[model samples]
Target: MADAEGDRITLSALQDTQAIQGQTVILPTALGVAPVETTGDPRIEAGWFDNGLKRARKELGQADRSVGDERLPVLIVTRYLVDGTLHEDRAIYDLGFALDGQLLGGTRVRIRGLSLITRVPAASGQAKLDARWKQLHPKLAS
Candidate 1:
């Protein structure tokens, strides 16, 4: 479904995501084994505008500007969950995961690459489902 429309993340995909919701997702940094939450479209999120038109544009002709990354909105626990932390600013980072499952008779998962953009305060920042972070930390990339 790589070329599928951004909205093509179907019920099956969502259901499949939820089915693994209870599973542990480990972020190498401070964030650790947090359960999976709802997911966004598993699109090749290329740039700032992670959702629609803008990202598509980058893919079409702006390869030079494109970070060429991938993202999926996997809501995991962060410093925000804690009442207070060292930094209140939001932070973004490239991340990865190691998932053990079965696809056709067994589970098949492949990662092309990963990278980190920036990081924000644990309380207010959000984590992008980028491949960069996972690339650096293989254990994190799944």
Candidate 2:
């Protein structure tokens, strides 16, 4: 949960401030469950990064009857433990929210542009392919 003062709460902050270090952040999928075991502090790129994927954006119609009209994206960039080695993974972003007991589009939490952890610029074709492969194929790429 975020603060009352409109201050966006980051996943890294949540993981750090609440002594949630060493916890494995898992993101479930239809294929299987993807767990991101943290190796160190998360590296945040910005307030949010929207890839224009509607699956991650919430519906802004008249059905919103829960929280106030506050919807934003937060991406979690961190070093994760992979095969006993530290690797910088993808930027996990969340923009989904539930309404009327139904799970809508993008999850309130989600992971996008993830790879096998790298020090490259993260803009290489191999990196994007790797990220997509992992997102689609799951454990095979990991």
Candidate 3:
């Protein structure tokens, strides 16, 4: 998390510190499941991303409860593992939290921009797609 003076604060420090009303904290999404294949079914891929958001929301909610009114402004950054590679996805700056539930307006979070540091495009065409499918989803393909 970044403080007003631009100093980074560790998670443990943030929990112990007090009255950080204006500070901004980065709440990263955890990959609870295995890495998803880039060339896999679109629905499954989308679900994986959705699950990451849910996980982040749950964490933020828990933290908010623990901190008890010292909830700093949160920036939820959702990450996904695609084809055994990690990719940082959308970063939601504005969010609201509630106990025993998800972040308010979570699903409506806008994907403002994509920052792709480097990308290795998956091989193209049917034969390559088939080969990649089998390789990536061995049990399912089998």
Candidate 4:
């Protein structure tokens, strides 16, 4: 949707699916994951996940800037839950269950990207959904 000035526009997903709703939409940082250390302890795998989350948060913050001279809204959905098979490179932790089967309650979505980890609520039909998203995920805003 375009603002009153018509120079800046806001865009967001219209679908309610987990893939579209929960995905931590971020711009690519590196071409791919850095070369894995062959000799490192298997326990370091957790560290890799932590580093990835940090990078994803950083990139999402950059994408939240307003348009033109005015501030526009940007939404960041994290830990988005999905029901289908994600490709090898795309899959994060397997919730190991169907989206419908799980009792998500207030949890709207969950995203686990290569370097991103977050969750967001199902979008309310608001013009300022982006701003609301930022409000909900303060860490990403930082």
- The candidate maximizing TM-score is 2
Writing each residue's lDDT as its tens digit, candidate 2 over 2-116 gives 4332223234432332332343333323212234444443332212322222222222122223343322222234544444555554343433322222265432323222223
**TM-score for all predictions?**
0.23, 0.26, 0.25, 0.19
Instruction: Please give the CA lDDT of all the candidate structures.
Output: 0.30, 0.33, 0.29, 0.29
lDDT string for model 1 (23-135, tens) is: 12223232233333333322322222222322332333422222434332332322221222221222343332122233444322223333345543444433343343344
Q: Model 4 — which ten-residue stretch has the worst lDDT? A: 92-101
Query: After superposing candidate 4, which stretches have Cα over 4 Å from the reference?
Result: 1-32, 35-44, 62-92, 95-142
Error of 3 at 124 (Å): 28
RMSD of 3: 17.5
Superposed Cα RMSD, model 4: 18.4
Model 1: what TM-score? Answer: 0.23
Candidate 3: where is the Cα deviation over 4 Å? 1-29, 40-45, 62-110, 117-142
- In Å, residue 42's CA in model 3 sits off its true spot by 10
Candidate 3 clashing pairs? Answer: none
lDDT of 4 by residue, 70-100 (tens): 1112223333234663311121211110011
In candidate 3 the C-alpha lDDT for residue 107 amounts to: 34
